[model samples]
Target: MFAYYLNKTLMHIFYKNAALTDYLKSINIQQTSIGFVPTMGALHQGHLSLMERSMLENEITVVSIFVNPTQFNNLEDLAKYPRTLDEDVKKIESLNPKIIIFAPNVEDIYDGKPSSESFDFDGLENQMEGKFRPGHFNGVGTVVQRLFEIVKPTNAYFGEKDFQQLQIIKKMVAKKNMGINVIGCQIFREPNKLAMSSRNELMSPNEKQEASLIYETLLNAKEKFETNSAHAVTDYVQKTFKKNTDFKLEYFQIADEVTLLPCLRKNKNKKYRAFIAVFINKIRLIDTISLN
Candidate 1:
């Protein structure tokens, strides 16, 4: 039997809109404070950490494991993206929180057409992940907006690993005047300091070891930020990764945390962070670190 948890007790699974709505209705969802954590399946320690935090703070926690195809800029990525629904459910069941797993199919959520709604994130979507992946944030904004409407959670949790996406979602909430609280969780990492990511599943043992260099480089850049200009530090990171053959450095920038615009020089009044995206063994890996 497939066992899940609700209210610190065991329960069965709920899928699609009708079943989920009926289940929530039976539980009087209106009176409960819901915490939502949306994922694209391929659950890992990082995902579990988000759920753990949600359970600690809210009466009911909901996690969605839909691999939203709209968010992928590349067709191959969407196709190759890991889908471990069975394993993911087992992980969620282990949490034993009053959690709802909204594992909806594309047609059910999208109504046969993915949202083409464009959002103006005040240029936040124009850099980094934006600059590289065209139409990615619009897809993100659309799906997240729909999810918010459907789940209507009091507070939603997101990891800071996708620092840019976290910021964009927050901006979308504000701009849309959505009353939901968006919580930014810490970036979970591996023992070697490589940030935990679903994409890490695609890496071979050697690629995984070499991927640690991404975090190591970020740490080096962090130290450089202490005594160097923003441009100099960025240049240093670029050159260092250029020397390594294991990964292709896509783009690295030291930018204002709020605006996400590349900083020409560090400013005392603003918080700066180093954002990086690298292609290791053809898998795109991203990581960020605070410069201030």
Candidate 2:
């Protein structure tokens, strides 16, 4: 039957990892460059963009979807998070990627034991998302470090939407001498400009529509800088969202991209970004925009 052949074809094309070491050995012997994009399933346009870039630049692309439990500070949020693996696989197959999907049993990857290995980033983790959701970055860094060890990727792709996390991961790679290049991909958004996120799946119809405001507000904030509008910076963004009762504004401030320090001045040549985090229907959303 066509179904049988389809199943066989899908296995060969998408889910190709038989063993971690075996896959690595094959790539090494062939001298193929490996690119990785790690995600927590519920694949969205944002994740695909990373994979597309990896496919274009490297001979092999590997994506892992683990819904890392270690990364979530709230058990309820973790349970509510989406997981559409069957559909996610179809999406990956459409890319026709020279890709391997690493969906391992937790025991295989983490030995089914509680992970005591935690990393402290010297105050980097304490800022932004860290201030609100403590222990998040350590969970992020822990799984990412494990992935780096398993994949040993020549290059890895992450999104700028998680700007703080990206900075910390880059620091980990550098300080630990991991010998992996971490590239930050631009945030992919919908036509209405909501930054694409797996958590967006949990949003109600109205919540998703209202979530567009997060990005729109950042755009307006960026324009403030572009037009050299020196009036109260954070005050402007906070006041704009104050009208939206459905959303709880987390933080809306412009900061230097590299130093993660708030930008108190408007200089045309100075690189700056507008970062915003708001809760729509109790689901937290984060986004950033460059002020050019």
Candidate 3:
């Protein structure tokens, strides 16, 4: 039947270590360059773009669709996080039937313990997102490190929308000497220039429309950053949000891209990015813009 072959084409999806392990063993690992794109499983254009890039650049591409519980600091968020495995699989199948999928459960990843292992990213974990969502980077580091161990991909792709987390992940890779190529991809945006996120699924039309200002404000801050101090730019972003009653500003900082420390004074030689978080109703959204 048509459904049988369709299902067979999707058989590359691995739910257990043995399935993925046996599949990988069939390939020539040393000779093949594997590209990995890991996601929490709401397949947006942003996620698909990463997978498309991986397929173009590598001999093989693997996409992991796991809703990482340890990564969520809030239990309610974990409960509300979207699980679109059926829809996600179809997207991956349409993208490339050959691309492998790793849809693991907590037991497969953490042996069911489900706790974050603390990591010292040289205080990189203490600032920005870590400052507000305590143990977030630790959950991130733990899950990512464990996934890396299990998947053993040659290169891993991450979006720059989570710019701070990307930097911390890079630091973790370097400190741990993982030897894998940690690649940072550009932030994928919506029609209104809002960075695409899984949390956007939880937003109402008005909330998403209002959330568009977050990126627009960040872009404005980036333009002002050329002639202004980081402190002034932060103030400008803060003032912009204060005028608008919709988005409650959480935190905003223009920081060194390498260190992620809020740069009060701009250093022309160093790379800096404007990072921001805001609460649009119950949904907390974060976005960043490069300030050269």
Candidate 4:
């Protein structure tokens, strides 16, 4: 069975603004410490883990599953992105937390108008995901900002798999000076060590095996990090993946964790990490590892 039981009592889904607001008001949400976990549907274990953490830390947990359209630079990718609302609701309900599922429609979120607010991440946008996917972070910022306004949660949870996105959201919260704490949870990985992602559903079994090489490469880089220079480690990873015909390596950056800037040379004072994006069977996958 997809879920142990369809516990309708635990899962409350809202598509309109008024109804959600009324319910939250009736429940006295303003008086409680609310934890918000925002997602783009196609729920996975990584999402569940975030919910579990939120539940442990806050009195009430709210999860939003709106696939923000503005985040997708490629129209086809946005179109192909998975949307399993029935299964997603089932998975969240299985957790048995009294969670509010805010699956708002585009019209409801945008209010029949477009989100035109621009965010300056101050060069955070010039890095990996931003450098390639133009205007992606803007969409992320817009939707997340909107959600935070609507939910008014005390704490927000995000997975570390999207490390850059996590940082961007934190930046957004800070810029807006919203009274909300942004928490970055650990990245959940599969048995083979490949970082779990909603996009994994598109991968065939053989393709999934090929994708594991991305993490394997990161592990290899981490080992080399102990003895090699940052530049040398990057070159090695690039050359190694170039030989593999299964996937095409987009970028492998060894960068400072906070600044998100590529490291010229390793500094013992600062923490460094390796971020990678690869195209496997036409689906783009990203993974990161601590080089230190």
Give the range of the ten consecutive residues with the poorest summed lDDT in model 3.
1-10
- Of 1 and 2, the candidate ahead on lDDT is 1
Q: In every candidate, how many clashes are there?
A: 0, 0, 0, 0
For all candidates in order, the CA lDDT equals: 0.87, 0.79, 0.87, 0.87
In candidate 4, what are the lDDT values of residues 1-292, reduced to their tens digit? 1112355354578887777777777786446888999999999999999999999999888899898888888989989999998899888877854677888888999998755478899789889998899888888999999888888888999998899999888888898799799999999998888999999999998888778889998999999998999889989988988899878888999989998999897789999889999998689999998876
Span of 10 residues, lowest total lDDT, candidate 2: 1-10
Order the numbered candidates by TM-score, best leading.
3, 4, 1, 2
Q: After superposition, how far is residue 239 of candidate 1 from its true place, in Å?
A: 1.0
Q: Write the per-residue lDDT of candidate 2 for residues 1-292, one digit (tens) a residue.
A: 0011234454322232347657567657565788999988899889999999999888878888788887788999989999887787778877763467777656656777746367867667877788788788988998899888888898999999998899999998988999998999998987778999988888887789878888777777767776655346678878878887888898877777776777777666667777778988779889988876
Best by TM-score: 3
| True-structure RMSD, every candidate | 2.3, 3.1, 2.2, 2.8
Residue 292 miss distance in model 1 (angstroms): 1.4
The TM-score between candidate 2 and the true structure equals: 0.91
Per-residue accuracy of model 1 over 1-292 as CA lDDT, tens digit each: 2256544677555567677766666775456888899999899999999999999998888898888888888999999999998788878877764477888889888998965588899999999999999999999999999888887888999999999999999999999899999999999998889999999999998888889999998999989888889878888988888899888999998889999998986779999999999998689999999877
TM-score of each: 0.95, 0.91, 0.96, 0.95
Candidate 2: where are CA atoms >4 Å away? 1-18, 227-231, 266-269
| Consecutive 10-residue window with the lowest summed lDDT within model 4 | 1-10
